[model samples]
Target: MRRFNLKEFRSERNLTQKQLIAKTGIPNVTITQIENGHKSLSKELRKRIFDAFQVDERLYVA
Candidate 1:
């Protein structure tokens, strides 16, 4: 599986962490931890994030 580049993804969409929190309903601290490599993504979080991005998950996986 390919690693998701959260920062790059947000940058490509012109999103601030707060904006992503608004869109994904993920907590700011959780997002911060994920970005800093201090936390791993749960499946539910991945689903929420991809849904917020409106992209097919298959595009991100091998």
Candidate 2:
């Protein structure tokens, strides 16, 4: 199974966690937790991510 690497994607955009938080209005802790696998990606958050990155949601899930 292929897995999406959040770190890589984020890095490719040159967006720091703080920058992502600013762009998406998602809290830093929540973003950190989700990136670290400490929390699941909520539907809202996933949508925000898609909006922020213009990437398909399926890439995030798989």
Q: Which prediction has the highest TM-score against the true structure?
A: 1
Cα lDDT tens digits for candidate 2, 1-62 = 23666566679899898888888889888888888988887777778877887877775444
Tens digits of per-residue lDDT, candidate 1, 1-62, equal: 56677777788899999999999999999999988889887889888999977888777762
What are the runs in model 2 whose C-alpha is more than 4 Å off? Answer: 58-62
Give residue 17's error in model 2 in angstroms: 0.7
How many clashing pairs per prediction, in order? 0, 0
Global CA lDDT of candidate 2, please? 0.78
Angstrom error of the Cα, residue 31, model 2: value is 0.8
- List TM-scores for all candidates, in order: 0.88, 0.74
lDDT of 1 at 42: 83
